[model samples]
Target: MSLVSINPATGEKIREYEETSQNEVEVILRRAQNDFLSWRKTDFEHRNNLLYKVAADLRSNAQRYAEVMTEEMGKPIKEGRAEAEKSAWACEYYAENGEEFLASESVETDASKSFVTFQPIGTVLAIMPWNFPFWQVFRFAAPALMAGNVGILKHASNVTGCALAIEKIFRDAGYPEGCFSTLVMGSDRVGELIDHPVVKAVTLTGSTAAGKAVAARAGGALKKTVLELGGSDPYVILEDADLDQAVTACVTGRLINTGQSCIAAKRYIVVESVAKPFEEKLLEVLKGKIMGDPTDESNDIGPMARHDLRDELHDQVKRSVDAGARCLMGGEVPKIKGAFYPVTVLADVTPGMAAYEEEIFGPVASIIAVKDEAEALKAANDTPFGLGGAVFTDDVEKGELIATKVIEVGTCFVNDFVRSDPRLPFGGVKESGYGRELSQFGIREFVNIKTVYIR
Candidate 1:
């Protein structure tokens, strides 16, 4: 069996990689485990220096990496470039702050001297997705590697090239042979990998179902797992919001990554007084967006990562419209080639509809109208997902209060789009998945928090 890479744009074949056999996987696992023994013993200074080198390498080759991402999974070249730079930032962030974050902390206990120390566990398996391929892997790898753990990536098959490129990045940066590796295999092998004795923990950035499967496998093995899963994030626009600003933010949020992001604003919940105007303004912007070749800088949207995904998104739109939601904008698939999906907007979206209930992982936005701010907030938290959300209002204090206290999501923003940052802990609640990634909290996720005491 082989893992094939297909260009979502133009529907062309890019490359194929031979799948790693069970025997080969076992060899890789054993080697990673053996290397971890030495890797975990390396001093923080040594690790930090290596990470710094990796960051420099990423920036120097950002364009080429971006091209690979564009070709492999249909990301706009510009966005792909940003993803690479963001990935480099993660490496640099961890390098600069990792040692301090993981330092032993003194505690006043009965013992004369006592402290809590963060220590690496062992080999960790990262099962990542194709959307923002580079950023997702680095976000997990940077902190895990900096904290003295090795990583083995099982990236989405469609982005196999990206998986290999990442392996090369670490290798060229002076990391040991087993420090980081990419396993070329399908999802069927995930359970086996999780069951492997060498794998001490698992981290996944994918669907809720995938997370559940991995969590089950790792749980039975008594291993830790951190899952960053699906999201149907909402962006609430209150009547008092700056209409132009709210429309811009919602459009940008919904269209980012061609709306493939787990945290992208999938649902726009607007107060009824402003719903019509918001819809009108949002429609004008959506109609103006240029969708074309990902390499083109002028294009605002690109093809989705796969044709099947594009079809699925279209089906969701069809269902929503059938359920009485108004199609305010593009709702049909483009007639041209490639896995291209047009920017679609469905207004009057309500509970139990496909657009309102499920994560539409494409360039489709569902707008729901509510009577007031209280109803808007209620609608925002009415989903099974709690990944990230934003609330827009002219009143900064009200927006801040709603974002900080009212919205139920892992991360919330006021008058802006939701995003993940290296400086902040990123994760989700409810079925969106548990545990955190990035920052001090993330680095400690795969570490042993051991307490030392003196008699």
Candidate 2:
């Protein structure tokens, strides 16, 4: 009847939350539908004002929220605080831009006048992951609320504590009672939530398998769905790249959030001319990263969110090594009680290996050596997952060409790593999931674009 939160760093109990029952879910659904009636008509200025209030609350109570995140999931304490700030930024961003994004645009027609208006549908069901819990929810909530849609969060079970805290943030910010609520339950309940007539759309950030299931459900219900799923993003190091800069960016790219990011550069494809140096430089850079307690701000790598996740990552590493990929460094699991794995580097990764073929969502970097730039492009686009990809080259024009024209991804970077920004759209291609989640593109994802004509 209750969901328990366990500390991934220390394997300790945080707290237990009562799961929402069937009856309670029905009430929640009703309230969301009721709230939408008035929420949809609220002026953008009024909505933005409330969003600004939410931003204020986020910054003021950032630490309190950070602590809960660090305890519930193994996110570093410093990163946890930053997540709070980032969430605040998202709120402010939506507050400032929602009106401009949803503005009615005139369309030329034979009639006297014509235009298209963007309007909110109803309640949106958000099934989010624990890796970047607060940020993901805020990114969706800020835009949805500003566009006049209500929200119902069904967050990852492990981080239900944070979910409850988020629900409190909305309530404290003076949103309507059902404007935003967290469902403290497991995945099995998601289908029921999505099937509710009041829930007009669904947005999920998780694995490909989960996205497909949710998409299918939403499709069957004839409801809109936006899925920001998994990614095995590739980063290419060309012969002309700045070795020092490439090494630094690639290290941070692969290791951010202990390598749990969906858009993190998972595969390192290097031309043979510079492959040896690149591999050497990458290993040297990662050697200094401290892997330990998430509570310690000094620790560069923390325990993974769960023991099974760590074990699964390890299995991937082992399978890759068995498939003829060489472990360049740190392939062994630790003796610690918590779910901890050292920063691993695998070289000679080819198409047949697990490291080359799958998404290894841990602090492990896999390297593949290609003969030339042509081969590098082939290697980078070899995977089914195409969430993001990047290229490093001293030739700026050439890098841009590769990043924009050649790489098959939702977002591509030339010199920098792939990251989500409030200004630009972010999502994926292939099996990574469809639909954008940031910028003006994201704000309009769940809105209804109705056409109006006057003769």
Candidate 3:
């Protein structure tokens, strides 16, 4: 099937791309392998300088790139612009810190001299997602390139234009031609690419099933893989928490990226003493959010990326409510032209309900009331996904204690909402997938740590 970019806002076809032929794919792999030989040999300073150039290019054309992303994926123009800026930040961050991060280190050994050096693992295949289209790919690209590994991006089908633009950004920055290339193809073709001799490792930021598939293929080939998958992250509120701050943060956290983020707060677990007040404040705040066209600067919430997603989230909400959950406010789909689901808030969520178990990838939040902190923690940990979780409490010690007890998550935020930063390592545990994606640890994910010993 042909890859097509459809505007989810108006259901218009923005562009169409033919899948890369098998022969062309082989040629691309060979060229990438050849480029890696020269590219990897380049000094760190040169690579860092080129990456800085790429960041500059991205910032210079941020508006144009944002518009393309908005048109292709229906993300609000403002958010799209921010996404591009974030990509630039990732590029510059890696450019600035990569050398030190990858520098060899001395270790004590029985031999006279011993050290461990980081080396580039040939070509890497990046199977990225559509949500945060530019940011997702750039985060992987920046660190991998800085670590001396070449990248081949197989981005989401709907964001092909964004993918091509990213490739152009790198080329414009004066990097070698094959240092990074966008492969316009279907999901089925990924296994072939993973098994190709030129491709040394694979990294994916997508659904759990997709991550598992690619990881299995890479494993069979004896190549390393990194998988960043989904989450139903919890927002836990203790009785001693700042009720007002927790409520406001919950609204923003749950609705960020229109609630499409993997780490978006899907479950709200509140201690019984503050549950009623929290729910009241949450409903009050959500009522004022403006939903309309993403291009409008005044709009707070835009449509989901596509109609099918909006419909799916709506159905999930409906099922949750029917399964004995109470709709506190805005449960039905909003009366709008585009793929818009209302900013919904559901309460009285039980463990057996679908919303409690599933990740609602839209502006929907499920509030589960608990009798005490113990029950709150139990409810929070009762999910297959453990990407992230947040705790709000005035007592720092109490918050830290609670955070430590909530096992299975890759990261936890004490008295704060969860967010991804370039300076911190980000990933998830359990079904959320394995492997780190940012910071010093992230840059080393695809590199070879070779140990040397001298007699």
Candidate 4:
């Protein structure tokens, strides 16, 4: 079987990569095991220097790498470039803070001297997705490598070019040949890695279904795992919310990355008193947007990562509309050559409808009106997903109450949209999967924290 990358913007085949044979997979895993032995012994200063080198490499060739992302997944050129910049930042962030994060902590014990030390495990398998292809891998890889563990990436097949390019970046920065490598393989082969003797742990950034499968397999193998799954994040708008601020933030949050993000604001729960005005302005902003070839600088939206993904999104939209949700704006799929989904807004969305129930991974927004603050909080926490959410209101005290006390999500913003940051931990709760990424906590995920004492 071949791994082919098709341009969603033109339905054009970008390239095809040969699949790795079983024997080759064995060699890769063995090499990673061997690499870990030496890598884990390296000093923090050595790893830190190489991290900065990788960051410089990404910045120097950002545009070229960004084009690969745009060609493969159809992100706007500008956003793709920004993704590269963020990838670089992840490298620098780990470089600056990893040593302190992994440092041994002293504990008061009856024994004269006692403390806890962090040591690296062996190889880690990263099963990443195509959306935000570059940032996703680097966000995991930077800290994993910084903490002295090697990685083998089984990235989304459609973004194989990106996967290989990342390998090159690490090698160019002077990492050992086997320290990081991309496996040009299919999803079925992920189990081979999980069950391998050399692989000590696993991490994934994808769907809820995929996360569950990986978690089950890793559990069976007694391997550590970190899974980041799905989200139907809510953006709660209270009656006291500033209409102008709420409208702008919601529009940007819903339309970011064409709404393909796991943490993007998919559901907007608005209080009844503010629903009419908020909906009026949101529709105006979404309708006035331009979308086309991602390479074009003027377009705000671009084609989804693939046609089938876009088709699935349209199907979700269709079901919601048929179930009585009203389409205030572009809910219809474009009858064009590419996999472009329109800027869609589904109003009067209620519980039990597809729009309100499922994660609509596209440029679609669902507005659910509520009678009061209590109902608004209930609606925000109604979904099975508990990834990320936001609370928008002019009353700072009220926004804090909702964001901190009410929303049952991993991360919630008081007056802004939800996003991942290098400075903070990012992940989800409930069926959204377990474990955190980024920041000090993320760098410690793959390390073995052993308690030590001297009598």
Q: Top model by lDDT, which number?
A: 1
Tell me the spans in candidate 1 whose CA falls farther than 4 Å from its real position: none
Per-residue lDDT tens digits for candidate 4, residues 145-173, read 99999999999989999999999999999
Clash counts for all predictions:
0, 0, 0, 0
Candidate 1, residues 299-355, lDDT tens digits: the string is 998999999999888998999999999997789887999999888889889998999
What TM-score does each of the candidates earn?
Answer: 0.99, 0.99, 0.98, 0.99
lDDT for each residue of candidate 2 in 81-154, tens digit (9 for 90 to 100):
99999999999999999999999999999989999999999999999999998999999999999999999999
Q: After superposition, how far is residue 348 of candidate 1 from its true place, in Å?
A: 1.1
lDDT of 2 at 273: 99
Q: Candidate 1 — which pairs collide?
A: none
Instruction: Look at candidate 4 and give me any clashing residue pairs.
Output: none
Alpha-carbon deviation at 281 in model 2, angstroms: 1.1
For model 4 the TM-score comes to 0.99
On the 0 to 100 scale, the lDDT of residue 152 in model 3 is 99
Scored against the true structure, residue 305 in model 4 reaches a CA lDDT of 95
Model 3 Cα shift for residue 179 (angstroms): 0.4
